[model samples]
Target: MTIRFPTLSFAAVRAELLARREIALLDVREEDPFAQAHPLWAANLPLSKLELEAWRRIPRRDTLIVLYGDHAGSDLAPIAAQRLAELGYTRVHVLEGGLDGWREAGGELFRDVNVPSKAFGELVEHERHTPSLSAQEVKALIDAKADVVVLDARRFDEYQTMSIPTATSVPGAELVLRVRALAPDPATQVIVNCAGRTRSIIGTQSLVNAGIPNPVAALRNGTIGWKLAGQALDHEASRRAPEAGEANRAVARASAQEVAQRAGVKCIALDAIESLEAPDRTVYRFDVRTPEEYEAGHLPHFASAPGGQLVQETDHQAPVCGARIVLADDDGVRAPMTASWLAQMGWEVYVVEDHPTSARQVRGAAAPVHPDAPVVDEVSVTELARHLRESPGTTAVIDVTAGVNHARRHIPGAWFAIRAQLAQAIEAIQPARRYVLTCGSSLLARFAAKDLRSLLKARGSEAEVSVLAGGNAAWFAAGEPEESGWKNVATPATDRYRRPYEGTDAPAEAMQAYLDWEFGLVAQLAADGTHHFHVI
Candidate 1:
């Protein structure tokens, strides 16, 4: 039986956005393809990993979800709609004529991930005339050891990977808070940069807006421009912004509070957060601190969304364009800095003022397991190894870890499969009497095992399913043999779309092309004319 889904016209979707309605215009395609061309507000929720991310990205099931894909040949919209419906989404629809239809209807398509945020950054620069110095100019200043400090406004890991010489790791939100401490002399020149334009522009403008005494400018085009200018970049540098003093903290609190207030951001307490939780509104509570800090301890019910990455990838972080976002941090700096950008991006954002004094705090990156998560039986890694040794063909091991992690190291003979593609993955594997699921930790594998059991039960198969206790780490600790590479992959590892600017091997041409695309986003935003951005 063919299932027909409701179709939304491109014009209708545009109207919905213009009307400020809660809509998730999703493009269920792999990241690389989706980045090539997509509607400005279309969130990339690839069908391949829908089960793993859909719930978090689009929290409300009743949200008006209109999915589209490459409609040139193969249509993925209907299939995605079916999957979303199965996942309990009530108001699911497919875009009529898909991408082609949107193009025909005069919809402005954007290239690259985080289109809305990047475009907003460009708009901010255009409106405010954010100051910037070219790579050569900044390099000359660094060579002369002038009264200058270069601040890398990217994540620490990104800064460690590659950065401008003499640049300190001071991520975007940290700029306003830590700059005073880093540059005590008012005559000092402060330069901010990231791999590309958005963070550089945002970070440089942040200090300027906060009335920092130092002369500030962005290292134009960041490390990319540095490399392009035949200037060498420093790798594995460990310089970081110093901790703010009481005086610095007081100043930052005042500056960030003023910025947040000007942006219409509300200050909410923990009790207020609880009250905001409702069936009708989708609220995203994020602790916009560094991952290391978040891992040390953070408030319950708040996910780790490092301030810099959250702003860079807002579309990926919050799919519902008009959703309310509440940001939290131990200090008053990161949350307000993050909330200000979110506000300018058209979200109803807030900063949590009260600290998590009495609230529960957890360690590690894994979010607390949902109460409704399915329960599955578990077996020890040693037991699984014995079973594999005894009945090699009868027992099958499925490693439902991230594709990149699986490629690095996995249990020998374990087939790599994404949790979202378990049903199809099981069918592709040779018939076995039993199946074992595992990830880096058993947390995700247990959920995968439950899914596998459901798929088996639906097919009336008697195959037993269980999660590997302690997962692949336990298997390695027990001295079990392991393998590497993409051999025996059940699904193509389209789970993560590689960024053009990530890693050292990206083609120079591609990087240049990416920069060119970003440079034109202001014009694209002008053409679209729907983004309600108000720079503070």
Candidate 2:
């Protein structure tokens, strides 16, 4: 059978970017390779999880999309195009020359994930001249016990890992609304920091843009700057900002609204939001509030997307560029402040005007993306454990989870395999009489088991293939034995991309290189004129 995919040329894609038209340029390769070098706006949607992720990240089925990848002679881009068509995506095409074609066409490529937002941050600082104090200057004030407060703008977990001494976790979107309450005295100087440059610059500028009375500055280069300066950091820091009082809310609300207006963010109501649900257009509804506040209660239709992270990870959250976004916030401050950033990033963004006070329609975490699970035989955790212990070597356990998680821990002697390469992974392991597949909760394993069963059938082998009833999570709960480290790997561990700025794994040299790359983003943004970013 002939498998033909419509192709989009690099020149055409570049034209769309330059025109500021809605286009989602996707790379259908594993994240590791995709992160190495791709066009500025390209989002990684690996073919392995295309079905699992495409419908959600791209809520609009008819969105204009162009895909490219290093197919390794596998024709992955065409396969992805067909898959998208089956999922009801109307306008899908393969990139004519893929990555090489992009380079040949004089297209600018960017490294690392979330390049758009990071580059926009540099542009914001360049245009607005956002204020900053070097790590040395910030340390001097702290050592002197001067009138200053350090607010870490990264996520709480990242802050808990390692943070500046006496720094509190108050993520980006919360900065504008919570700053006044956190530092009531106008005399106190406020400093913001993140894992790297983007959030710190955005967070500090948010306060400055909102016209907060306190003096503010970003910790230059963020925690990386602190580490390079040879200063010790605090681990397991639990300090956080308190909720804003009514007086502070009033001030934050008014300030945020003005900033949103300046950035061209729109105010929308429920009826207007419903009208956007037309068949031809895609609209994303995100509640840009704290997860804890959202988990307590949120509108049934809205997903929990904290404002700061949404701006940082727009590619991950809203992969479809140019899609309309409606943000919901009960406080009337966080959503507008978040919307302001989105507006500046060339998005048609809005904040709900009549956000519900009693947002009790849904509770707990955002509902997991619901895809039809393929039915397969199941083995209970206790049964698998008994077989592995009493009758060792009879059954081979294949854990179909993220490589990082599998390396951290798995059933004793289990082999880690990327589901996309399950056939090759199965062949690499010593031939087994039976196979049991498991993931964090068996959700993904269920799908992999179905594929494994068909592979065995095609080979005329009657090997039994079953999904572990509760997956890895259930096994640990049952006190099943486990082991760490990689063994008998079929494919390279390229599923997850390790950020150079994250954890202590990256060396000082790599950290310096990351900072150097950030410092040059303004120039790159100029070379690739698709980004319609500006600052007030």
Off by over 4 Å in 1: 1-4, 69-83, 274-279, 295-300, 354-366, 369-380, 383-398, 417-438, 442-469
Can you write out model 1's per-residue Cα lDDT over 1-536, one digit (the tens) per residue? 55899999988898889888889999987776788889999999877557667887887889899999763367878878987888889999999989999999999988878888899999999899999999999999989989999999999999999988888999888888899998999999999999989999999988887889899999888888888788888889999989999999999988888888888889987778877767777889898887888888878778889898899889988999777899998878889988988998889998887665556367778554232445778899779989989878999999988888999999989899867667668768998999999898777787678778879998999999988888888999998899999888886776677877877667788889888988898899989888888887
TM-scores of the models, in the order given? 0.87, 0.96
Best by TM-score: 2
The Cα error of candidate 1 at residue 278, in Å, is: 5.6
- Candidate with top lDDT is 2
- Per-residue CA lDDT of candidate 2, range 1-536, in tens? 54587899999988887776678899988888888899999999987787788887887777889998775566578768887887888899999988899999898999989999999999999988999999999999999999999999999999999999989999989998888887999999999999889999999999998999888999999989888888888899899999899999999999999999999999977667888777755789998988998998888778889999999999888877777899998888999999999999988898989655664568899766746878889999888888888988889999888999999999988888888778778778877788999999998898788878889898998988999998899989988788898875767788988887888557889889999999999999888777878777
Clashes of each: 0, 0
Total clashes, candidate 2?
Answer: 0
lDDT values, one for every candidate: 0.86, 0.88
Worst 10 residues of 2 by lDDT: 354-363
